[model samples]
Target: MRSLRKFLYWLNIVGMIAYLIVCGYFQMTGKPLYPGQVGLMFQVASGLVLVSIPLIIEKWAHVALPDILVVLYELFILMAILLGTGMQAYSIPNWDKFEHLFSAGMLAGSGFMIYAARTPADKQDQIDPFLIALFGAAFGVLLGVCWEFYEFTGDSLFGMNMQRYMAAGKPLIGHPVLYDTMGDLLSDFIGSAGMSLYAFFKIRRDHSWLNTFKLHRIK
Candidate 1:
């Protein structure tokens, strides 16, 4: 078991490094970065976190819940950048649906992470799972806000407008709002909240009534 866990841990690290290489190559070649780029890095960080799982198994892990929260915040920021860039790239082809799906995944992943992190060492039910879910939803909205700001910056810098046909032409203002940046933001929240609720029910199903009560009623 130990060897297998260690192998999985290192394998995750190698996968992350490989992803970084691909992303760097794309950036160097002036390829437009996509929605999953930052997510790939986020997975790398998550993998690095997993590398400590062996220590965590031995109860020598140094990371605290707040530290984990900070990392989660960073993950959300990177995901927002990725999602916004994808939106910018595909805003012309009416392919914002893919962008929405990406945003949804970001929100959902954050929600699951929050709940998983809160699970106690001994219990199947996570501590304050609802609160963790709330945290995830709030961060989703926070990421959405930052994404909108990024979109505005892109508009200002690259002269890319979402309103009208904005790409590959002489950059101009008064684009016809081809995409709903705000709508994407709301969709992010929806996805996050939905996943959180799903996890909540899953916990309720997998554990005993006594354990559930312990999570809710214990000190």
Candidate 2:
């Protein structure tokens, strides 16, 4: 599992580097680039940094994130930034919504990890399952909102249509403009809620389930 995790990390690094090189080559050759290609280049570069964060935290903070979580995080970056943006997979119907749903669920799992890390192992079973579910759901929703804020900022500052507010160089109007954002939020909520319920039930049945997902402090 550790080897697989390391492979994914390197795969993202190499993939992003290759993408940047290709983009740079196209620009230097004066080749026509696709619309939003420039924005995707920025995303690819940012993804490189994003995928490296786990190692940075582990090395510098003396903390150890679970291998499964790290693998999931790296895979999300690979699919979302490397393939979704680079290959224009967002053009596929419903792909963006799927990504949002998956991301929220993963983030909810992260919330559980955070909660488990803070609670003493002996007292974990004593905590209310309702609180656990609420915390995970809230945390996932909060991060989902933060991501929307990021998309809005990117659209405003970079002229990117990340929020889907514009089409064909024209701004959308009425309910259509609200559709994408609202849909994304709804998907996020559903995904998080589902994961929270899973956590609530699993923890109630077996507190040992968290042991598989818990983070560790390095000595």
Candidate 3:
């Protein structure tokens, strides 16, 4: 696990270095510093911050997030920045939607970790499966909404058009923005729902599932 963690750390470092080089080349060539250039920088910073989350939570809140989850989360963020948005993969049909789905699943997993971290092992059985699913899905949806809000803010603050809120210098106040935003939300919900349902059944069938998730049950 330590070796794998170190590998991921270095992988991110290399990816970030490559990203800066590419963006710098574009900037020097008089290309606009939008989309991939801006997004790559943001993703690199965000990935660094996310890499510290597990350790920070462990120290401050006494929470131990699963190592698998930490790796998965970092990989997804890197993928989005490095391949999806950073590579202009939105030109491919439904690629953005796939990313939204993936992100929501990651959020659902985080929710499961949080719930597991807070619940006592002995009392875990008393919690309903439906409640587990509901909590995880709800948490994922909340995060999805918050992400949309961030996109919205980005659109307002900069002309990045992160939310598909404009075309040809005119704001899209109608079906375009509505369709794009709602579609993302729906994808997020569906992805999260699937993860929550699986977690619910796993816990229902055996308490041993907790061991697989790598969270320490609170006393």
Q: Which candidate leads the pack in TM-score?
A: 2
User: Candidate 2 on 1-219: residue-level lDDT in tens?
Assistant: 699999999999998999889887886687836566778788889998899999999999998887867876887788798888887887798788888877888888898888888889889888888898899999999999999999999999999998899989999989899888888998899989988898789888887887766877899
Better of 2 and 3 by lDDT: 2
Q: How far off is residue 26 in model 2, in Å?
A: 5.0
Report the lDDT tens digits of candidate 1 across residue range 75-137. Answer: 333333332232233445535534554455455545445445465646544455566456656
Compared to the true structure, candidate 2 yields what TM-score? 0.82
lDDT of 3 by residue, 1-219 (tens): 556755775677677667777787787797945654665667655666665566677677775667656666666655666666566666787777887777888788788777877887788788887898899899999999999999989877876787777778788775676877898899899989988888888888986685556565334
lDDT of 2: 0.86
Off by over 4 Å in 3: 1-10, 19-63, 157-160, 214-219
Best by lDDT: 2
The best-first sequence of candidates by lDDT reads 2, 3, 1
Instruction: Estimate the TM-score of every prediction.
Output: 0.42, 0.82, 0.74
Residue 140 in candidate 2, Cα distance off native in Å = 0.5
Query: Candidates' lDDT values, in order?
Result: 0.50, 0.86, 0.75
Clashes of 2: 0
